[model samples]
Target: MLKSSGMWWYEQFARYRYRQGMTYARKGQYHLAISRFNRALLHHPQPDEVCIARGLIYLRLGDLEAALADLDRAIALNPCNSKAYGNRGLVKAQLGDEAAALEDWRVALTHRPCYAEARYNRGLVFAHQKNYQYALDEFDLAIKANPNLAEAYLHRGNVRDELGDRFGAAKDWQLALLNDLSLDAAKKALFRTRRESHEQRLTEKLGAVLAPLDLSLQVERQGRQLNLLIQREPGTPVNYQDVAKLLQAKIVDLNLNWLERFRIIGRMGTGGMPDWDKVYQIYDNCACPPIYLSRILASLLFFMPFGIAAIVYATQVKANYAQGNYRAALTASKLIKWFYWVSLGVFSATASLVVFGVVLLLLRGESLSSIIESIRTMPSPRPYLGRPYADPHPDPSPQPSLPESTDSSAD
Candidate 1:
């Protein structure tokens, strides 16, 4: 009984020494921790926990090889030690052996399912792989295990943003900031995502309105020269001859109207590519308002190959229909313009499919085919201007009544 009591006392003394070593290690006193750990080992010849404490201290001191050796001895003595696996995984990750790190983390998780740090670390590995969905799932589990985990929230928010779930990203970032007010990363991410989302919505609204920009513009270039023509509206009559004369003189002076007014709008560098951008702006803002539709079509032609001409014309023709310029709209129908019609018919089916796909993608359900079909079915106009024809024999009008009689005889 006395010997057993002495053994117990020795065990307590060894544990005390091990704890002192850990405390010193935590305070960055590596030499003191090492000295104490050595003393503990002398007192208890084979103490696995003391060995673990010494190994962790060695790790904290950056003696990774010694730390790993101690950890191996500790694990061999206590085969079920979960913390041993976790520490090893940390070392492996530091060494950039991600697979080994992952394996160790999985083993640790198998022993302790609620290990928040392990889960967070594994999630980081997945994130580095760009497997955002997997990373997010791991982060979600970590957060569930430890709701106060600000790091988990931040990482999850980053993954959400990458997945294009901006709202979810912002929510996670906001939550992270709320829990850990000092986490500057969380705060910055929240602000950035919110601003990006706001800007994205603004762009979408503008995109919807400006999708028709491909309709009202035209561009043509002859060797070493480019010309952009915006057709004037027939309905809104202007001095065509005067404008033509002005254009001729400007051409002679090599000073087009767009070049003069371009400076008023923005500098050339604002749009990067001047020729392409200048043409689009003119189509959108020029006074040849009806011709605006044609200008946009011409710009589309200039950008894409000649194959896009039909699609651009279709878009312009549809815009014209929307504006009630039925004559110009009808003239735009490729079938009525037999020259363009014959050109289209000559294309192979493969080319036709390509053009059709491009048109559908650009139009995005604008009903171009139906508009063109309707315009084609309408009869060609005669050389005359008159009110839109209703039914020639209109519904019978009420018979006209005679004026009232004097009625003096009746009175």
Candidate 2:
């Protein structure tokens, strides 16, 4: 009877420590939380709850080996712990063990039939393996389980495209967009596919016209504009006016509003030749609102206000440049130039005032050495206070807990 009472006391203390560890973990003091969890484990080594909690903390810290060990122990202690299995799958996936990860996810699903995360993860693995049909099935089930699963819809669209169902793919993509899915790869794939189709049609129409002139052309889409490269054989005489007329006719026939910003370049000869190339913009549409907005935001930086707006516009410049929007970048560069000049003037003025004040102080009663001594004698400022708590072990929450939401792992 006495031994049983002692065991009960130990379990209660261990539970108390575990609760304290969880509090520290929520507050982002990971190291202190892990220490408390270790103490809790020392009291009840076989408790699956402690193992699972510590395993999650290890995963957060990127200690895959320790996380795997604890998760594996938790699963062994209680095979029905769906949270443990799901987390083990995450660790295995991170470690590049896709086959084992899939099995763990399946086990998690078997334990809890409505496990949306496990279903989604299984679909990801299937997609990676090129099993599009299986992946589609899993994604469908995941979406059915949780209709708001944006990633599942995005991947489903990818599978539909892989299966050559363009109409279905478009529908799925629209649904994904409606759900506000932010999948960069999916968006890029859609853009590239559409651009290739447009290029193919344009090439067919331009091929016959170029054949008679003995000039070959290549068309490329760069961001919001099309670039046409006209190449001629060496020693061939080209009429710039005639070539421009022909290109302009073709662009008018196509009637694409975005193509109005096209650029045309002509080159002759194989090797380097003197003044053998001509480059010019086809249209004058420089008053684009996005570019104007960027420029205006950049100008505001000169007032020593809206510092964050300046940073945002600078980022916009880089993004536009990366997207091959040269006109937008050029316009935005004006703002950056103004900001540079204004900041230089401000810095110079501030430095001049500091120098004048120091000179005045020296001319008066203060010596440089005395100023240094006074600065040294000043008292240090107090450190910022952290979370306040008298005891390391606090009371536990009344409600039961499960694993943290799966969205964190997706990020």
Deviating ranges (above 4 Å) for candidate 1 = 1-3, 43-46, 201-411
RMSD in Å for candidate 2, one decimal? Answer: 29.8
Could you say which candidate leads in TM-score? 2
Q: Across residues 174-205, which tens digit of lDDT does each residue of candidate 1 receive?
A: 88987899999998888776655644553443
- Models 1 onward score TM values of 0.49, 0.53
- Cα lDDT for residue 25, candidate 1: 82
lDDT of 2 by residue, 1-411 (tens): 355877888978998999999999999898999998998987773589899999999999999999999999999999999999999999999999999999999999999998888898999999989999999999999998988877888888889888988767767777777787576766766676677778867766765567788887777888766777677887877786677667756664455656545566677754454333444454332222133444444445444554444555666776776776744665565566666556657667888997898788889989999877877898999898987878778778687789787655663
**lDDT values of the candidates?**
0.65, 0.77
Worst 10 residues of 1 by lDDT: 261-270
lDDT of 1: 0.65
